[model samples]
Target chain A: MIASLRLRAAVVSIVLLAVFLGAWHLATRSTGTAANMSPEYAKLMGMTATQGKSAMPGPLDVGAKLWEHLRRPFYDNGPNDKGLGIQLAFSLGRVMLGYLIAVAIAIPLGFLIGMSPLMSKALDPFIQILKPISPLAWMPLALYTIKDSSLSAIFVIFICSVWPMLINTAFGVASVRKEWINVARTLEVGNFRRAFTVILPAAAPTILTGMRISIGIAWLVIVAAEMLVGGTGIGYFVWNEWNNLSITNVIIAILLIGLVGMVLDQILARVSRLVTFPE
Target chain B: MSIFDDPFDADSRVNAGCICGQHRSPAEHEHAMSALRCEPVVESQEKRYENVVASAVLRAVFPEATTRRAFLKTVGAATALAAVSQFFPLKTATEAFAEAGTPEKKDLKVGFIPITCATPIIMAAPLGFYAKAGLNVEVVKTAGWAVIRDKTINKEYDAAHMLAPMPIAISLGLGAQPIPFTVPAIENINGQGIVLSMKHKDKRDPKDWKGLKFAIPFDYSMHNYLLRYYLAEHGIDPDTDVQLRSVPPPEMVANLRADNIDGFLAPDNICQRAIYDGVGFLHILSKEIWDGHPCCSFAASREFITSAPNSFAALTRAIVDATAYASKAENRKQIAEAIAPANYINAPVTVLEQVLTGTYADGLGGVKTDPKRVDFDPFPWQSFAVWMLTQMKRWGQIKGDVDYKAVAEQIYLATDTRKVMIEMGLTPPKDSYKSFSVMGKSFDPTKPDDYVASFKIKKAS
Candidate 1:
């Protein structure tokens, strides 16, 4: 019965995907003719017009382009041009560095603030004000002060990712069961030892959840930051393709960004699952 | 600060604390250091820079192009003029190709927007001009003009492709931080067009575009100034009569298609792109407005020029040489082929071919051939910079009085270009201050203030 349920869901997902792709294919198929176009322009825009293809790329075009990208993912032609894999790797490298920095800062500060009611109350307003700011707003200031675009991009990723993890870690640490903490106190376990053994385990799942969210955000910010900075990354690839007016390459980049982001989320989700414990 | 504050004075040249690198006395390098493992290459490169300086100084010194450096008095003046290039961090950096002058830095990054105007700059790589000059140059296509500006300013790029007016604007601090940007060579001339949406194919007159929205690549661009000049000449005030927004060139065509903008004064390929897509029509080329007007240029931060003079020289010479090659009509198709690769402009060969060859569809069902439609002349004229200053003042981008000549000399490095022209056996007009008419009205560069005052439908500064 369980196997049947899995099979049915898979079938439904396949049907939905097929329907989506089919609609996209039909909608973006060539639209207008080059019938009344200028003679010289007509010659240059031959297939793009005479074949009545829409200026926007179709699903098939994206699929073919994506296939091309997937086949050779690490070719580096020059400083401006690199394979999709290389770009993704650059993006992931930046994200991981920034995300780890956030994790390093957030978890400790979050723990100290959560352990003390005074600190939490004092920091709440600042956190509240800072959390809602868009990451890119810091770009100009980062670039001007840091004097480095790539470092500025990484800083943007760090700023956007830190707050969520910090808030979540604080909330998780603060909400740890009072009874379990009291028992640890009753046993007179040392403050540091008791906390690591008792409270840390209790808040592990929640902290992991916070970490998962931060990774998601870090991934999101890197694309936009790379686009702004324009060096080497998935965002740069999308922008470069857009400049080339190659919608096919942009679509392919978009797809790969999604794929990498999903993989990142799934990895964090798996880590969080490992930390979860039932009473 | 007074607008006439003369940021570039003679006293400042001797004592200025610039980040590019300080120059040693000319005699220090003359003896050839024990470190000169490659003295001959360095000396030759120095000779090249000297020729460029001599030619450029010769321009500043004489009105005629043929006054050779042989006349004793002229030669002494030329030596002094060449010495002027030394106090400034340009010549010696180019002289040494070995351990001493070995590019202070190799593996240089250059940024550019993917337009046909950037062909000479982009093609230099595949054509191996940079390599031939002992440079490992990597030219990356940038997202937009703003990013190129930022990346170059941030020191992320050693140099960049910019609109001719952008270096002037940056130096004057019109839109960003006040940094000394140098335009050593103009990349292309007359490569822009006014592209109107398809709906306005019949409404081609400038007077008729009273209420339409228009897009220009940047505020500090020849496109914006040219469009404004063209509009004002037609009695339409650009500011109030029509909307002009700074949109990236790639997005301009899309905006036109979406009816977001009625038209754009943009670089080639974008204009051709619109007509190719059947979404717009080419109304008129910028060349028609002012033939041989400088468009985009090869610009660098003053810091980069001083720090890596040799690399900068090699890069500029490569670009100038490339521009010389691109200027010839016979080699244009092959030049077009070289730049149309995926790593370069990434445009369809036909579009680039049309832009380079000057045979294009008018988007009005007519095939027109205008051979000088988009010309590539590398010399950066001081007068062009002066013209840009006037527009900035005319539009109120710059306030108070301007030391136009001093600013032009500082920003426009016409002297560097003199050598490249000599290398190619071409004589750059020593005094390239040639005046030209725009929209049937003559502009005297010497009287920029009068020119600005003459415009009727101006921004009311």
Candidate 2:
């Protein structure tokens, strides 16, 4: 029965893949011909006519180009050297580094503010002021201050990642059960032991949710930051391909970004699951 | 000595027992011990002397190794490697010949906004200029300059008819990816104008551009930069003296009409449309402010330029030829008719012809005609580029000192441009540089490097 189920799942996945590719192929072919049928297209198409040669390349021509690039994808073009793998790795590394830094700074701050009314009053104004500012708005200042594109991009990711995590962490820490604290006090537990043993475990699930949100924000900011800064990153790849006027390549880049983002979120989801108590 | 007499003595019973196995006379044993000690000491001394001599020989033979000789060898090897790498890149570019050879990537898509400067591109497409150059060009209509820049950088289009500064700004990585860009050909020059709303007629005259609220289109846009530069020349601070707001190009006329903005800088065609509608009047033509200023050009990726040199050259020739044709009086009507597609500006033939011909009725009953209004001379405008670099420095768009000559050399490919001009029987100017005296300050293009260095501008240290 298990073997049959596995076989059925495999067949379903294969069929889905075939259907997706078939739809893509048909859509591109139809659009390609329609675009060429216009008068403007005819004028442009006339430019490439050699006595017997075809002027405009059809969808097959672009597909061939795509296949050619896919075959040897590790080739380095110039100073922005590295394959797509290396570029994605660089981008992912920046995202994680920035996300971790943000969490490290935000969590403790959130805890302190959440625990004390006075502390919350002091920090609330600043948080409210900063939360509404877009990540793109911070790019110019970051670029000027940091003087390095890679670090600027990382800093942008950090700025974007911190807010949701901080808010969530504060809410998580503040909403801890009053009964648990009373239980710890009756047991005559020390403050440090009580805080770690009772408060932390109670807040773990919420804090993990905040971390998941932070990671997703980091991933989103990194792409825009990389595009603005320019270097070996997935964002740069998208911008570079777009500048070359390759629409198919742009689609490919968008797909890569989406796939990578999904994987990152899934990883965070798994991590959160491992830490949190089952419902 | 006896063992019981002195337990710590050298001649104790334990010592005597040790010497009992190989017993010899006292004088002979002493002599053997002395010989063994001296032999080792002599051998060690000899080894030390040999080491010193060997080190001295090595030092003497290769005295210059630490200095000049090693340095020269390293430099020579580096130079050779650099030369080889420069000559042979990874991907061999396909040659783009006008008369022959297949276009490497033929189904070309280009993007442009409806600006007067891009009139030639609109004209060229319908007239088969791009086709003649072996480009299957598709002109994608963009919303505005920002969208055009975004789309161009994103690779939605192969090339673009863009503001001259767009490519430069993008290449320098001001706010976007440092895409390598080059203007293969100049599209048109001196089509932009500054206009004032009718509400300003009582407060300010047409000549007084400084006393009004200047509605700039976008930050870091050419219109904003140029307006700021023009204001500064007249001793007006754009920040303190007047309120500057960011408004889109399509809304510039409406904003002025609604009295929301006092004045705005826009292209000639749009300003003329507003004047014809009796909403606003021409304050000053930016062309008059800086005559023969390089405004817009046909920009392409550096990758495209390198990959398809022949195609680039062909495209340049086509643009140059088209510029010549469009400038002639006989071809003016035909050029206007060709560009009248609804997807383009959708303006009547008369409006396009008047703007293209540089004949403007100043909206105050006066007509001004300048024959050489928009000079298409590619080489002499290196001064304008230098001027722009200086302005960029002044406005904090660029930081640190760039080698102005090198930047000019990269952006302005005089050799290729001039070669195309010569083939067309046009006299390509021998002198590369020109001098401009703007607001009584003389800027010599020949001394561009020194000129940029001497400017009192805030630069990144």
Candidate 3:
């Protein structure tokens, strides 16, 4: 029975792969044909006049470029020079630092406001006012105040990431059951012990949901912030490619951003599942 | 006692009491006692002990209850204080200014575009010209001319290498907010050229720019106006007869190569790149189209210039020195190498050298060594500014009429820039304004408005 199940799963996977590839092939062929006849595509679609030149490379060419960039990518083209690995590292470093800082401040503060009625009443207006402001609006101020691109970009990420985490954490903490509090009181458990043992464990799933939301926000803001700041990072890479008029590179950067965002969300999902009650 | 403890009698009495409580008795006091018995007593005891420890610890830390409100107030105050202390380093600001001298403001941030005109600024920073002047210069590469103007106007940038017309436009309230600006020095002149794709190299001649799809970096840029003048002189209407789109300098060659654009107006290095790439050709150098037209100038917010005069002078000196170095024949190759590696205009040194040397190849098997190909005259304010004002008037960018001279003076800081030039042993123009013949017709400086109104090309209806 196990062997049959494995065989069925294998067959399903192969069929899905075939469908995906077939669809991709059909789409590319149609787009290529349409592009050749269109006035807009005339510029980028034709063959170069060079002796061995061919038509502008299709999807296969993009795959080759991606593979080449991935392997042995550490080349310094000059002073502001770095490889794809270094660029990705720098981008990820800023995102992680900013995201961690956001969580460190947001979680405790969220708990305080959630646990106390008066505190929540006092702070709710302020959060409501600030949460609606766009991250881009803070960019000019951040640039002048911080006086550095990397720091400014990180600050932008931090500003954008904090709100979702704070909101979610507050909701999570406030929703702890009255029965649990009563049981803690009957046992004469300290407030700190009660919170850690009962409230936090119960709130884990919600807190993880906040983190997942925050990470997504961080990723979204980092690209735009880096583009404005302009240094070494994926955002810079995207801007540089656009400036160079290398649309292929821009598309690649977009793909990389999407892939990374997906992975981060998946990791957060797994963490949430690990902490939540099975039932 | 043995006689009294009868089992059946005792059981019957208890059963009767329970039945009475359930049916006969209206009050249920016995049920409450049973519910209390099922409560977890140990859990409450543990909670009490934990709360006691936590309270003790809190008292040890701070003897005041201060309520959560008071504590939050303290935290809020502390955060405000910490934020102020952490972000603003006023002491460093003074020290940086003091060490650099009053001539320059402390912590200087200079903005530049990715073009040959920005060479002097780039070279000066790494070569420590600003550092020597006691200014800490951070060179930032801007996206385009519009951003440079916006940032400078808003005081986000201390100063910027901007288009010659930008300060004038700002003074006239054209593109930017109406803020007074000053040009401390003319950074460079005649660095711009119009490049055509290699495909149209043979068909479209430099003499004819009317039929082609021409790209200018900005709508109101000096190049756009100059191109318009050029086409009109050749009896072609720039508006209806030709297509003009705004394309950034760096992307010009690619656009040309892609055949999306027939040609574009860009600085010299970009034109050189087209030649090197074997995909484009030089149609007309802007200098050739109009002799000694000002392309870019070093500008600062009027507030910065007035308050920090010494720093302004120091910056002017450094730029002047760099420009002098850049103009020398022997330094051409070195300048190319320095600029080529910077990723601003990532092209070969040879391409840059050709364009920088003023001996441009006309792509149609012709060469011209026009001595006036790239003139770096600092004080031709009247010609360029007046021309810009005229273009503005022509294009209806500025609708209402005002004193042209005052408008020009408000925009052009020629008097201030002349002082710096004199100190550097360069000849400053005696007259603030001058007139010159452009495309075989004399442009009168005195009658600037009339010159604009009399243009043969009809204004957009």
Candidate 4:
């Protein structure tokens, strides 16, 4: 029954995508005659426009551009114009660096916060205050104080990603089964050993859940952050294409961003699954 | 100082001939030696240490044991140099300019808002001017005019493509954190246009623009001031009669199409782009408002100039060279191609060509060629700065009696710019304060207060 449901869901997704593309194509058809404007203006409008209306691209235009980008994703013409692969690498490199930093600081600090009531109580107000702020709000302050745009971008990601993991790890550790700690205590398992063996295994699933949440939030924030910073990233690429009024390139970037985000989420989900056990 | 060439004495280092060794004539030596100034001259002279660039190039070029010596000894330095020149142009290139004291900082990032007014600043990178001057410079495409100013202020950018009015505003601490900024050279002149949406093509006169929405690149930009002046001269109050918003040059066309703005007085290729897309029509070239009006400028902070003078000089040399190269009508098309890639302006090649080549469709069915339609003369005149100050005063941007000449002379690096202009073989004007006319009204630098007070349709002062 589940397998049938999965197959049906896949079919439905395909149908929806096809319908969307068909609608897009139908909606953007050239409605105006081609001869009203001068030859000069017509040439400047590219293939999208015939008359005076916008050449906001259809699916066909995006698909062709997407294919072009995929064929040569690593071409580096210069500093300002890099291929999609290079741009993605720049964004991913920033994200991973920021994410790893968050992990290193979060997990250990979160363990302390969860283990000790005093630490958790002390840190709670700060986390509550900081968590709700939009990541891009921190951008100008970071750029000003840090005096480095790239590092500031990374710093924003780290600040934004740290909160969820920290909260979850704390929650997971605090809610561990009491019997596991008692058992370890009775057997003369050292404090470090108890944490590494019993508490860790019990809390692993919840901690992984937090990490997954953080990764999703991190990916979302990076696009906005890079767009605001405007250097080299998928966000910059999208903003740049928009500046040039290339809606086709923007569509391609959006598709790639969604695809990359899904891959990131899936990898985190896989890791979460690896640590999960039956009740 | 030892006048004699004592080979055994360590103080004397072989009165080094020009690296090419072909031009040791008295005239050539005079030319080369005049370029090499005395010690403690430009910014990078104080590593207080070694000649790292030359040694590094030598080490990288000849890594083999004793190969540099062997090449100099056996193969005869000239032939070896001839072979090396194909790869690195060692024989022909000016080594002085490369090593010119040492760059205190090499890898520099110059910020620029993506607009064709920044042609010289942007084209210099792709055309190898920066590299030729022994600097590894990256032209960072900034999102807006405000960001460019901020980045330059925060030291994130070594220099920036600023509006000619910006450094003056920045130095005065108007609408920004007070940082002493200096304009080394103007980037482009007379490259803006008043473009209206296609709906208003018939509404050609400024009087028809009452309650019409308009956009300018920045308030501190010549675009805004010129637009204001043009409107006021036609008895239209820009403040009340029409609306003006500051949109980035890239978004001007889209805004026009979206009906967000009825028109804009903005930098190219934005004006050209609007004409190209059929969304907007070119109403008037900005040169019609004020011929030889200054636009974008290559600006650096006082901190940058004071700390890295040689680097500053080298970078300015590259910019002046580029500006001189761009000033010529013949080179405009190739410059358009050079900066048309995705990395730079990212506009269509045809759009860039039309803007640069000065032959563009007026977006109203007629092709026009005003050869000086858009130009690149990088002279940062003191009088231009004074005119901007008066405009700034004319608008409510700066209040309180401002001393025009002192501020203009300080911010506009006319003397330094003159030195560079002369070095590049383009003769700068004899006096930095030359008068110019705007809309049939002549502006005298001696009386800015009179100029500001002469305006009737001003914001209530």
Among all candidates shown, the one with the greatest TM-score: 1
Model 1 chain B poorest 10 in a row by lDDT: B34-43
lDDT of 2 by residue, B1-461 (tens): 11011111222222233232221345544443322110111122223233333323333443543442343345553453344336543122111112434557776767665656676666667788777677777665554566566656655566887777777777777777787887766666566778777656554433355546778766665676677767765667776667778765656766776688888877656666555444666777777676656677777888777787766666676676666555555566676676654445544444565566656555444455654444342332455556776667766778777666666657666666766654433434444555766545678876755665664422334
TM-score result, candidate 2:
0.49
User: Which candidate would rank higher by TM-score, 2 or 3?
Assistant: 3
Q: Which residue runs does candidate 3 get wrong by more than 4 Å? A: A1-203, A231-234, A237-270, B1-107, B126-136, B154-156, B198-214, B231-243, B258-260, B343-345, B359-375, B458-461
Best by DockQ: 1
- What lDDT score belongs to each candidate, Candidate 1 first? 0.79, 0.62, 0.68, 0.81
Total clashing pairs in model 1: 7
lDDT (tens digit, per residue) of candidate 3 on A1-279: 999999999999999978876665455442322312233222212133222233233466567778877886677654344567777777899999999999999999888878887888888899899887777888877765665656878999999899988988888989888898889999999989988998899888998999999999999888888777765788877776665445556767887899989999999999999999964
Error of 4 at B270 (Å): 1.3
Residue by residue across A23-85, what tens digits does model 4's lDDT show? Answer: 999888676666566676566544433463447788887888889999999999777789999
Q: Rank the candidates by lDDT, best first.
A: 4, 1, 3, 2
Q: Once superposed on the true structure, which residue ranges of model 4 sit more than 4 Å away at CA? A: A38-54, A116-122, A177-194, B1-107, B131-134
Off by over 4 Å in 1: A31-41, B1-103, B423-425
Better of 1 and 2 by lDDT: 1
lDDT digits (tens) for residues A195-216 of candidate 1 = 7998788888889988988998
TM-score against native, each model: 0.85, 0.49, 0.66, 0.83
Worst 10 residues of 4 chain A by lDDT: A45-54
Binned by DockQ into CAPRI classes (incorrect, acceptable, medium, high), candidate 3 is incorrect
Score residue B356 of candidate 2 by CA lDDT: 62
Fnat for model 1 comes to: 0.50
